[model samples]
Target chain A: MTPATPRRRGRPSRTESADTPAARDRILAAAREEFSERGYDKTSVRGIAKAAGVDSALVHHYFGTKEQVFEAAITLSFAPAMEAPRTVEEGPLDGVGERLTRFIFGVWENPATRKPLLAIVRSAVNNEAAAAVFRRIIVTQVLRRIADRLDVPDAELRAELAAAQLVGIAMLRYVIKVEPLASADPEQIIKRVAPVVQAHLTGPGL
Target chain B: MTPATPRRRGRPSRTESADTPAARDRILAAAREEFSERGYDKTSVRGIAKAAGVDSALVHHYFGTKEQVFEAAITLSFAPAMEAPRTVEEGPLDGVGERLTRFIFGVWENPATRKPLLAIVRSAVNNEAAAAVFRRIIVTQVLRRIADRLDVPDAELRAELAAAQLVGIAMLRYVIKVEPLASADPEQIIKRVAPVVQAHLTGPGL
Candidate 1:
């Protein structure tokens, strides 16, 4: 080993040559796999670091803690779809419902991307800590972003109600697997649900 | 003890004088508490019997297995609101959404009744057996009845969608406790949610 090579105090040998941006992405991906397979409570930091072929200190160096790792995984899972909220920023408010519905449905209906989200929702249903983290992500990363694009009164409440409608459908579709909704035409669901979402976003109250 | 009284085999001394309809109700209530406090995998018949202060055999006599006890408790928890399907039986179809939403919100928003229902939802999320039972009840006791009342072409699909929406809202408001929706006024929620639900029940597709 070169004496000039940087070494940390009480740290294990590096699993790879050096840290790079790709290393952080690799760690996040490994975290996703571990969390989705075993859920929040069962996954460990060392396990994720090992799977990522990085030192345990490297895992801690990148994400700091297991909870933070999960948070970053959520960002990785959702960052693509989170851009949909920004779609609301540029488009007519009327199309927001269809755009939003199609966005979420498109993301969740795909098995590859759906695994981590499913793990998070199922974990949140039973574990308080997971639920807290899940809630923070949904509220801050997703709903609040969409609400910020709106000019409506009570935008925050409307944003959440809109979220509830879609979240509920996803729960029945994926978690509870309620038939019809579980297997019904996604376009049909979007058609039926979009108007309500639009109304929540910009309609006069009853 | 009187010789006149007949005792069942392998039974503990009568926990109470004799079985009555009220005794059955007590057993059902105790079963609800056990299943709700602990998820399905953790709850047992003996624990329920002990909680109800009855012999374990008496519990078996009333409800055959752990699954049966769970179904009965779900039935008991849902029976009051299950009648909303009947509201559709007599009311105009357009108002079915409002009636249905009002009924569920009434049941769930009230803490006294929400406990058992919450247990069922949380339990169903993780336990396949509990999920099966919950699905059966949602299909036969709830959605099917509402669907039967409709003359729409895809009544069953529509019924399930409506269920998806309400179930999602209930999940957010109570289970996940998402902000805004969680604290939103029940009546206001019904007002806002009703129209969307109505559209899902009766809309022309996109």
Candidate 2:
């Protein structure tokens, strides 16, 4: 008896199908551009689908909703709290300031991360739902983790202060596009700003 | 003719009419309320007029456009850079940090100033025109003065960094309503965060 060849089922295999990582990337890229250019309220699933040359249902299949697609588009993989604690854990505690500062500047300086970050800031400021998402991400992923790691008597206060300092720098230099700051030397900023971040993290004040 | 019976001319005397400080106050209060609730974009002159219980033209008379009305509603008679420089000028060059920090905290801590400041932030974030007005106000009224006062080589950079830090703290604590930060004790925040601000202003690294 001859063995029958396996029949391909639902969606065709990659070689036989049009869907690819390239397509997914194209869709997300279009989504980011649309969201940033027109804002969240005006951007539409159909528009993104057309921009990516895919059907609307394909977008739904890949990302459940406009909100979910927006999230996927602006996803920040850099977990500062996770990496920051490790930095704090290693090396002399005194240098923790410099390390943390370097990490922050590095994240912002990297183009891959900065674009999405800027989008998040612009959207959060422009839309209520996006702002709520932003607030949640900061609270749960960044602030909560950092606050938990701090040994300070007022850990929560210290964490909020730290978040303010970092986020503030991001806002001024990146979002507002203030001159000199927008073009300042990254190393110089890190050198000067780290100690202050360090102080907020582990400095001696109440 | 008996000198036209001593006629009162231009606009009828508000004293003779129903117009009162109480009425004006009611209108201004309502304007602020509406602006805060709906933002500058969603708000209309007629809407503000309705909220204030006056005719739209009356609002125009008192304050020309919605922008003008917003400016009137939120104008700060006290200038930070003006008073802040005076405060810091008295202290030793090294003490600029403490002095500047104290002055900024003083402005933000006062409810009279804080409410108007919050209104400006809300308006600025939501409306491009408002944001431009805000940027102009900050540049001419705040940053330019601060930059002029600095003896550092990167005086402008220093001033901007200082502005970012100060504004960031206010945004998180007052506008975004981030927990622990939103409700954290002001004095503790000042003590912990002020030195970082001072460092940005006059730190040795710069």
Candidate 3:
């Protein structure tokens, strides 16, 4: 460890070897596994650091507290799904529903992304602190982004209602693995559910 | 301990006092508290029996297994929501969506029902066995009933789609408690969300 090694001074000390991006990614990955397997209440910074083969100070250095670790891990896992709001912005307003639905499901359909997502949802469901982190991320990063782009009244409510429809489908089909819905083709679901989502986002009042 | 006390023949033996409806109810109530507090994977029949102040044998005799106990508790907790399907059968097909939506939300809006339902959802979310129990009860008891009554083509799929919408709303508003949607007035939500639910159940193809 050289005195000349770059450091973000004033933060708690960390091993220079643990400061690399690879080390950070490893810690984040380990945090996901610990949170997924043990859930939010049971997972700790020490556990994550041990799993990552790094010093405890390193986990704290990279992510702060256990809750911050949870936030960082969830933010990474939810990154793909969170990008769906961008789909809402890029497409014509009329087709945003199908585009957003397709984009969100596309993220869920892939096993790599889906596994972490499943872990995130399970943690969020089991722990209130995890749920609060999840809520803030989804609302501020995802739903609010979509709401900001919308021309409709009740835009935030509309964004959440749209989100609820998609989130529910994910719960039943993926998490709960409810039949027919679970086994049915993904495109088939997008076909049926997209318009209702569309209506919630842009259609006239009930 | 009267020899004349009625018992189901050939089952595991149990105390007569533990076999009464009050005892069974006590056990079931205890099981809910245990599962809710501990979640499905961590909760045990022994724990539930202990909480209810009864012998483990009596819990087994009455509920059979931990899964069965979960099924019974879920069935009981979901009883009110399950009854919403009957409203579908009673009303004109045109009005089924509003009636069904109102009925389902009504179950969630009340704190007494909401807490157990929240527990059931958390259990389902956390464990596949619990999810299976929830899926079966919902499909056979609730969604299937609504599907059976719907005259539409693709009835089961349609029923599930509608359920997905409401379940998503409940997951967000009640369980996840996302703001705006979480704090929105119940009737306002029903008014806005009911039509999308209706569309899923009965509206024209997209």
Candidate 4:
């Protein structure tokens, strides 16, 4: 919830905002709240600024648009998988699928980041703008990068497929909280899913 | 869309529901609109009744509960794919992935069903009751059947993993409209994704 012990003050004061990172964090926090409440279409820089107790200009100064703010807010907490492409690039490739599955499920299981991530997913389902920001992150940051690392045809497609499977499970397990997926043992999921991920990553052609 | 020429009456006559089918259609249509617009948690039986111009008691008579109404509303549109588990059981197993992808995506790409299906996915993302209904249909109606037909170890888990991938694709491609995926050609998707599905269905144990 709170980003950290406020470096500058308990609240995001104007002076605190001038410190760049603190201001950005406050703006991001504001963006998350606004986006969660109003979604991407309704949330605006001005509103986020008002919530963060910063000038509208400062919200823009920290993040370019509502889209950018959303991207930053959601993906900031996705730091765990930011480098997931490397899991493919450097690994023996056989276990990349497991790593990918484990990495994503691990993120969802985590308490610190899962709340914001859930908000992002929940909003994205209903709003096109939110979907766009979410899509950009999944493709550009995660899928495309991993696909590019592979030496296969339809690499990108495979990667997207793998990502889609994980996202669906996440939808049921976390966002929707569907059972037995909602309550299934994590190892049960990992054992079943990882091999499929491996197939998408390094398996033969269609 | 309108489901064929209504044999009964243009409007739901109070007595028409006595015939069963007409009343059920009216209730389903009302349920779809209410759930799409207000989501599962927000939608009430009274609201659906008002939308259908029927007594809330009639809605109860037809669908049992709000949860049941939500279930019927979503899965009703999924009628085409209801036979999909049989596709696995009856067909050459290797093409099951392609068949499954084609079937699910086919449901999505259809004009009549897509709109309602979209509503279900969008609403389910945030609401637990809707999610539960969705999970029930997916697990019991579809996933379990396909798994039961399979002659493999952890058949249910394997079936679910394949499904998770496909469901994830639906989340991004349909619900979130994530790009390249959102825009990519369906044939292109089926080609890349089907193999992984095949692997999950009958490939060697992990």
Measured over the true interface residues after superposition, the C-alpha RMSD of each candidate is 7.4, 10.7, 6.7, 4.1
Q: Which candidate comes out best when scored by lDDT?
A: 3
Which sections of candidate 2 miss by over 4 Å?
A1-31, A44-70, A76-92, A147-153, B1-99, B106-112, B122-133, B147-153
Off by over 4 Å in 3: A1-16, B1-16
- Per-residue CA lDDT of model 2 for A108-143, tens digit only, reads 888877766665666666566766666777777666
Q: Which residue pairs collide, candidate 4?
A: A165-B165, A168-B168
| DockQ scores of all models, one per candidate | 0.35, 0.23, 0.40, 0.41
Single out the weakest 10-residue window by summed lDDT for candidate 4 chain B: B1-10
List of chain B TM-scores, one per candidate: 0.86, 0.71, 0.88, 0.85
**TM-scores for every predicted model:** 0.82, 0.67, 0.90, 0.82
| lDDT, residue B99, model 2 | 74
Which residues of candidate 1, in runs, are more than 4 Å off?
A: A1-30, A42-66, B1-27, B45-62, B203-206
iRMS value of model 3? 6.7
DockQ of 4: 0.41
Predicted candidate 3 versus true structure: per-residue lDDT over B111-189, tens digit per residue = 9888889889988887888989999999999888888887666888888889988999998998788989999989999
Task: lDDT winner between 1 and 4, please give it.
Answer: 1
CA error at residue B152 for candidate 4, angstroms: 5.6
Candidate 3 lDDT, A132-156, residue by residue in tens = 9999999999999999899666999
Residue B2 lDDT in model 1? 9
